[model samples]
Target: MGLLWGLIIGGLAGWIAGNLTRGGGFGLLGNIIVGLVGGFLGGVLFRLLGLAATGMIGSLVMSVIGAVLLIFIVGKIKGRR
Candidate 1:
């Protein structure tokens, strides 16, 4: 199904993003969670900005970017503690 593919792709994207950004901080489940949420966030962000992703690759790219951004923000907040 579409949702299944989305999860798989999102997971992969998230894993890649994590590795690239922070040497892979979150575990598998965490990455997938971040991916899915990131996908939603990316879509919403694009829409609000009057932009659109082109295809699966584009979506994944945007999602990964969002996930990395989210992780960075989390890291910043956590570092203060």
Candidate 2:
């Protein structure tokens, strides 16, 4: 199912983003939230560029990009504290 794939890819992307940005992850809830947002952001970006993602690899790549962006934003916000 699409939902299943989304959860898996999003979790991976979020984990990767957190690790890369903060040297750690924000736990299960954080990862899920970031991942869900990342998936939506990825889809939006792809659409904005007049492109479409295809297959597992493409989706994963997009998710990673979105996750990276999300993590960067979150890191910046957290750093302000």
Candidate 3:
């Protein structure tokens, strides 16, 4: 199912993004949330930039990029609090 695949890809992308940015993951739930939101953000960003990504790997790349950006922004905001 599409939902199942989305979760799987999102989780992986989130985990990868966390690891890449902070050297670790944000647990299962956090990763899923981050990844799913990141996927949406990535899609929008790509669309705005007139970019396209096809297939699993491409999706993963976009998701990870978005996840990393999201995490960074959140970290900055939290740090200011």
Cα-based lDDT for every prediction:
0.82, 0.80, 0.92
Q: Best lDDT goes to which candidate?
A: 3
Clashing pairs in 3: none
For residues 1-81, could you state the per-residue lDDT of candidate 3 as single tens digits?
A: 989988999999999999999999999988988999998889888999999989988898889988998998999999998
Error of 1 at 35 (Å): 0.7
> Which of candidates 1 and 2 reaches a greater lDDT?
1
* lDDT string, candidate 2, 1-81, tens digits: 988887887787778778877798768778767877987888898899998888978887787778778777777998899
Model 2, stretches more than 4 Å misplaced? 78-81
Q: What is candidate 3's CA lDDT for residue 63? A: 92
Worst 10 residues of 1 by lDDT: 22-31
- TM-score to true structure, per model: 0.85, 0.78, 0.94
In model 2, pairs of residues that clash are: none
